[model samples]
Target: MAKTVGDFILERVQGWGVNRLFGYPGDGIGGLVAALGRNDDLEFVQARHEESAAFMACAHAKFTGEVGVCAATSGPGAIHLLNGLYDAKLDHQPVVAIVGQQSRSALGGNYQQEVDLQTLFKDVAGDYVETCMAPSQARHLIDRAFRIAKSRRTVTCVIFPNDVQEAKAVEEAPHAHGTVHTSQAYSEATVLPQEVDLERAADVLNAGKKVGILIGAGALGAADEVTKVADLLGAGVAKALLGKAALPDDLPFVTGSIGLLGTEPSDWMMQHCDTLLMVGSRFPYSEFLPETGQARGVQIDLDPTMLSIRYPMEVALAGDSARTLKALIPRLKRKEDRSWRGEIEQRIARWWREEEERAMKDAKPVNPERVFWELSSRLPENAIITADSGSSANWFARALKIRPGMKASLSGTLATMCPGLPYAAAAKFAYPDRVPIAFVGDGAMQMLGVTDLITVSKYWRDWLDPRFVVCVLSNGDLNQVTWELRAMANSPKVPKTQDVPPMSFAHYAELLGLKGITVETPEQVGPAWDAALRADRPCLIDAHVDPDTPSLPPHISFSQAGSYAEALVKGDPDESGILTQTFKRVFS
Candidate 1:
């Protein structure tokens, strides 16, 4: 039998060291699916939907630093991949999406499932998106997609028309004028700033009495360097949400998360610091940072464009986080003043006590903060944790204490929902020996988590450790958006839009032949997690938490307070509970 274009593409991807492809089956991609079946080297992970597949690919890239690949059919299946691919693009993860197109002859004829895939993928896969018009084009398209996705750390796409996919494969391009030759070779360069710039950045840090260091996802590999710099400069370190695992939370001068879902110590450090060094984080909220001109600023980022856009830096070094910090550390003089570090440590200690007090506050049933706080102490070493957007993210940012060696992330820039389970599953696949836990809300669980559970049930038995746990906060409300209406829009929550329909997520997991536990009281929260972690298979914990428990910002402005008052005056459906919870959280 002659090798087809589909078979050749898979062979090329396997050559690039991709061991798995995530996607769903469809007739448009029948050729590729058949080729995949024939190939034993590459495993195909079947996701419930194309969106989940894309998310899995994104998470794969995030967890394993490799180019993740996902495939789907034409039209709706291809469209479903957009959101997840955008999440990859925004968060700067490498992902290659392979989608099927209709027959070439029927492309312009508007045949069934024939959408303009090129234009559809242009925005998400803006760096590269091309169609394989012939067997000869397949090699270059596949090569370029993987290379560009890996080199650029963004999403890339390759569209395969149904007819072209089944055509005879062309392993190599001819050495002619029109033919193009490409190879599956890419290597990440170690970027470092010039000595002159590193010295200037060091000078700025040395001159300041109170220095603050901000780390983001870019600093994940530079933990030791960041710590050395912090200790030498007597600086307090604050983490952006994406960089939660960049540094351990147990450090004395390490303030927790920064920005809206930040800790008081982080906000305080930002407000009072005399010099600020921002590393590999584009945290988006300028108000949360030190006021302009009040502090000397320096920033380091691999992407030159991201360098000084968030905060104006006197020295903007375009380089890798670990390497830049290492170069800068040699030039920095150790600060003898220990007063600032001591003050920051005191604030952090007080903040944790406050967090504990807030988490333990009584609510209608289970307090959501307590769920995460309890999990923080029980998180297994080397565990990978993912949280969905919504109230779950609020608690994830504030309550959870990420220790060293534990990997954690979410849809950082996109802040999208329903990626938690998919991310965890991808993490488990990447490190079969490590446990992966997902913190999700009922709304997200209802949206897609429930269906993805079957994906877990199917794959768990093969994993070295069958300890995938999905912790669902069943609050019966779209709690995050509801609070945003009151705090941001100054409007009362409209029950019709804010309320979520309840579902038995635990029961659903049990039906899929996985363990299930329900926690209706605060006492059950800790025990439930213990049970789930010990289960022989994947487990789901349905924690029925209070809907009115406030996800308060570290510090509230007068305007936000005014909006809350206005919303309450306008008669919010849960005004009484909201007021009570707000008071308890504020005064605790």
Candidate 2:
């Protein structure tokens, strides 16, 4: 039997260790679909929508640290992948997308389902994008796509025309440069800094009496090293949202999260530190950062491009997180005075007390924090959690405690909705033995949660375990946007635009042959979580939380306070009167 270009592409992808491809079937990709059916090594996950497939691929890469792959037909199918692909690109995850195109003979004819994918994906896949024009080009193009994606930690796109995919492979061809059948493997190598760089970083740390550390997802494997460095320098550590798992919450001097959705102590630590050591993070929001000349800085990143991009650095060390920390630890001088660390720890303790107070509030309806606090206590040590954007993210950021073994992920860069459910499904597929939970906003859940629950039911028994839970924070409003309207602008709420109809996501789950639980009060939150965790199939928990609870920053500016005041004066319904409730929860 003569092999086709599709055969070669699948073989190369399998060789590179991609065991699954998430996509939807369509006419533009019929050839590739046929090829996917022939390859037993690759399992194709059929999503209800191409967008969810792309989101699944992005989540898979985030969890496994490998180049995740997704496929789609050209035109609309390819366009549907943009949102999730952007999620991967912005977060610096390795992902490869394959899109089907019209036959070469029909080029520029405006054929049915024809579109220019290269231009469409240029921004998202700036690192690599090309069409497979011939059978001989399959091996080189596929290998290069994987190589660039893994090495650069960016997205890569390959467009396959229908005719080209069906073409028979030739032993010798015009496009052939080398052996077409040879196998090659590639892996990202550890990057380390020079001795001089490490010494300079140590000098920066040693000169300051009060040092602070900002850790990101790049520092995931270097928790011990990061703690050692912090202990040696008497530094308080603040984690970026993506880096929440870098250190356990129980660590005394570590602040949970930074920026708008951050703890009060983290903002204080960032403002007061004389020197800042940044590892594996290119955290934006320079407004939250120390002012110019406020602190001497040392930044360590594997990508040289990211070093010192956020702030001016006295020393920039380009290296792997664990290796760089290991090298620099030996040259550091331990601080004798533990007062700074003690003060920061005290602030952290106070912050936790505040969080607990907020969680324990007995508002008329239900406090959103109560649900997260219950989940925090009930979550398995090894659970993988996903949070959708909006108020749900604020609760997840502030309330959850990410232990050393646990993993938490969000659309940090894209900040897109409708990804939480897909992310949980992907995590469940990737780590079947581990529990996967999605903390999703009512808006985001209504957008795709029910549809993806069907996908979950389809693949539930395909894996070793079926323990997936989707927690819907149903407040019947776009709570975060509403808060933004009140907190950022001194305007009355746009009643029609911001409010969502009350939805029964739990009932929707049950309709799809899955378990469902609805919690309207504080007491029901814990028992609902308990039921979801014990269920053998996927479950949904619909939590009716207070919509008026404001996610106020630790340090609210005068202007922001004025804005909130103005909104309250200008006919903003103090309906649940949760503003006073929330105010006391934060200040009192």
In lDDT terms, which candidate is top? 1
TM-score top scorer: 1
lDDT of 2 at 26: 83
TM-score of each: 0.99, 0.97
Q: Candidate 2's residue-wise lDDT over 1-588, tens digit each?
A: 577787777877888889989999887787888888788878888988899999999999999998889999989999999999999999999999998999999979988978888899999999999998887777777888999999998999999998888888643345445545433577569788999888888988999998989999899889999999999999899999888878988788888899899988889988989999999998998877888799999999999988889999999999999999999999999999999999999999998887888888886577888889888878886999999999988988889988779988899878999899899888887898999999998888778766888999898887787788899988888888888888888976887988888878888888888899988888888899999999988889989988877777867788888988888888886534756776666667
List per-candidate RMSD values in Å. 0.9, 1.8
Task: Tell me the spans in candidate 2 whose CA falls farther than 4 Å from its real position.
Answer: 170-183, 574-578
Q: Which stretches in model 1 have alpha-carbon errors above 4 Å?
A: none
Judge candidate 1 at residue 450 and give its lDDT: 84
Q: For residue 588, what is the lDDT in candidate 1?
A: 56
For model 2, give the 10-residue run with minimal summed lDDT: 170-179
What C-alpha lDDT, on a 0 to 100 scale, does residue 54 get in candidate 2?
91
